[model samples]
Target: MEFAFNEEQLMIQDSAARFLAQVSDSQAVRTAMARPEGYDPALWQRIGEELYWPALMIPERFGGLGLGFVELAILLEQSGRHLLCAPLFATTCLATPALLLASNPAVQDQWLDAIASGATATLAFAGTPGLEADNVQAVAEPTGNGYRLNGQYLQVIDGAQAQLLIVAARSPGSQGDTGISLFAVPADSPGITRHTLPTLDQTRRLARIELNDVIAGSAQLLTDAGQAWPLLRDVLLIAAIGLAAEQTGGAQQTLDLTLAYIGERHQFGRAIASFQAIKHRCADLMQQLECARSAAWYAACVAQERLDPTGDVGVASELLEAAATAQIHASEAFFTCAAESIQLHGGVGFTWEYDPHLYFKRARASEQLLGSPALHRERLAAQLLGETL
Candidate 1:
């Protein structure tokens, strides 16, 4: 099968790279990260209007551009390279996919429309890492006409800017994932509170969210009780593919930056890039970055095919393997490239004023955002062995 990007996808990738390069420089990202909202509203609005990146994957019937996830992945790569501090990922990659997988008609006409039309959203899926599999940290109780939710999500990306809060909460009496469901909570809902939390990657903000008896109408429910995990699994696959794409982009940027630095830095009246050892290191990083790009792109292709892992064992295994492979490779490549780039830059790379550390911090933070490389490898191994994860 052909693996190269189509003409349109290539155009999207090139245009996104150019747009981000022109507008989202390091200074712009720094300014946005320092803001309370964690992004420049004007820039976000302009991209939504001009590029429709947020609506790329939403269906045309739902007021979207009707593009595929590959297009979205292309844009995400550029976002990672520029460290664009925005709610784009929270809205497009996370919330949009959650709604799409929800398959609720009412949700489509209401919340999805707003999101496709450029509203911001943040998804609270699973509690912080290290929770027991049997543990359900958040719950929603049926209240006749609606539901009452009580729970705390310690980490939410861009919670402050999200106009919609998509929460994954379990039914009070249900066990494990069976009792879980998806709900779209208005950000201003009463009994709900959000506080920004400092993150290792300043470009991607985080927040702590608490809900105590937050009331929700039946119309607000996105998934039937106990049937949301399958949908969530699909969403996770898509997210992994998209994040892999972003990580590939970050790795590429790190390599490019390091090469430029080494070429310009002279030692003993000769450019360091000409040294054999430095060239070998750069070549190794380049190989990693290229492999990551291939893996990420292949995963995106699988996601675009709309494979249903739950329907067929072969499909499930393939999808899981593809996502795990892409995520593990991309995560390792980006972090390795970031770390080596810094070390290669010598003393200047460690300082706050220098930009490599910013990328290094992003690498370290993203390595754990979804699941670490080791975690992904463990899951992949379980699948390959035909054992439970």
Candidate 2:
């Protein structure tokens, strides 16, 4: 099979990179991150109109460009490079999949359209780090012509900006996984509260959402009570792929910035780039990035296929490998490249005002968004041992 990107993929990457360079410049990202909501409405609209990155994840019948996840991965890579602070990741990568995976056609029509059109959204899954399985602290009870939801979801990315939320809650009095259900909650619903929390990544926002006796209509259920596992699994796989792509992009940017800085900065009356130590270090970084890019490409290819049962097993295995390995290598590369870039730039890299620090912070933060290096490694070991983690 061919590993190279087709012309269309190259064009998408070029367009995304150019757009980020022009609109998501360091100053622009800093300004946006400083805002109360931590996103730029104007820039968000510009990209939505020009590139349709948000719509790229949706299917054609649902008013989308239907370019599949690979193209979206390319766009995310550019976003990572620029540290573009926006709700696109939450809306496109997280919410779009959740809506598509939901079994209810009516609910899909309502939310997927808005999500594809760039209307912001966030998803609340119960299996996030520190959240326990078999934990039914949150529940949904059938109410008059609707349902009442009471629960809390933490570490919700861009929750404050999300106009809609996809919440995973269990039904009261049901046993096993049979009681679990997915619900679409409007952000403005009464008894729903969102509290923004400070995080390591300034470019991305987080929120703790609480819902107490908030009534939701039957029309809001994404799937029949229980049986949402199939859809939820797909959503998680897509999320893992997107996160891997972003991490790869950040690694690439870190390496490029470090190389450029070393080439210009001099030490002992010679360019630092000319030194053997710098040359070897840069080569190693390049190797790590190329490996990550390969893994990302393979995972993206898997996502493009319809994610069938046989394909799912293969893709899941490959995706788990790619995501975990890419994250580990990218994390190491970013940290090393960022530090080396700083040293090459001398005192300038150490300053808060420098752009390298921004990439450094983003690389560190993106590392943990969809599970961590250690987590993936553990999963990998389980897979090798003929057991699922």
Candidate 3:
């Protein structure tokens, strides 16, 4: 399949790149990340209102641009390049899908509108240090006309500022896969508490939530307990693709920055880039980045095509495979590229004052988000073998 971006998509990508480069300057990102909030609400509003980022993922009926995930992925790639400090990915990509896939129209209308209008939301998944998919442990109990949730959910991205939470909780007495139900709980619900967690990547915020008898009304359940699996899986899969795209962009930038630095910095009366070792390393990064971009773009294309209501089962498999491939390649490439970029810059790269470490921190933290390479590979292998383990 030809995977080159079309003119419109390229334009969007360029615009996003330019916008993020202007808004998320290195010093600004550093200052925002160093703050207790770990992000800039003003910057968020600027992107959401001026750039219409939050509305990009929502359907037209919800007062959004109704663009496909591929476009959003392009924007996110730019976001990663600048390490934009906003909850755009969590709210627009993760929580929006859960709300859109839920069975409650009223809930969807309310949350979707809010999200499309720049209101932030988050997905609360319970996991340990270096969390992966299938690490969730939150539980729900069926009550009269509602469900009572009690559990500790960790690493909720942007949880401290999320107005709504799209939660996946195991329901008591629910049999089989149906036992897992998704909920749209308002962040201010009684008995719900949030504690911000310290993180290496100060640009992205995380929180731990404690819920005690947190009542989820009937309107809160987005999908039937049994039917939420497919939707949740789809959401997570797309999220993986989105994150992979971001990592790919970040990797590309690191490569560019390092090569530029090497080209300008004179060593032994000549530019260091003239060295064979540096040239070979840059070539290696180029290959890795190309492979990552192909996977990410292909995944985005498949995801966009799958939006058609009549798409075949192969669409699902392709989406899974593409996302898995992108995540694995991009994660490794970003890490390698980050390390290489620092090495290429010599001692100056190691200092906190340098911008290279910021990308390094982001690359490290983002590698484990959503799911890890090991986890995604296992899932891909299972799917490829026609199993669901």
Report the number of the highest-TM-score candidate. Answer: 1
Candidate 2 lDDT trough over 10 residues, lowest sum: 127-136
- Candidate 2 runs further than 4 Å off: 131-137, 173-178, 306-322
Full-model lDDT, candidate 3: 0.83
What lDDT would candidate 1 get against the real structure?
0.83
* Candidate 2 residue 287 C-alpha distance from true site, Å: 0.7
Give me the displacement of residue 91 in model 1, in angstroms: 1.1
Kindly indicate the candidate among 2 and 3 with the higher lDDT. 3
Whole-model lDDT values for every prediction? 0.83, 0.76, 0.83
**Backbone N/Cα/C clashes per model:** 0, 0, 3
lDDT of 1 by residue, 148-259 (tens): 8998886687887799998878887777668778788999999989999988898888888888999988778788766777777766677778889888888889888998
Local accuracy of candidate 3 as per-residue lDDT tens digits, 104-213: 88888888898888899988866345333345567788788788898888888899889898887876555444667788888999989999999888889999988888
Model 2, residue 370: distance off in Å is 1.4
Clashing pairs in 2: none
Q: Model 1, which residues run further than 4 Å from truth?
A: 130-135, 307-317
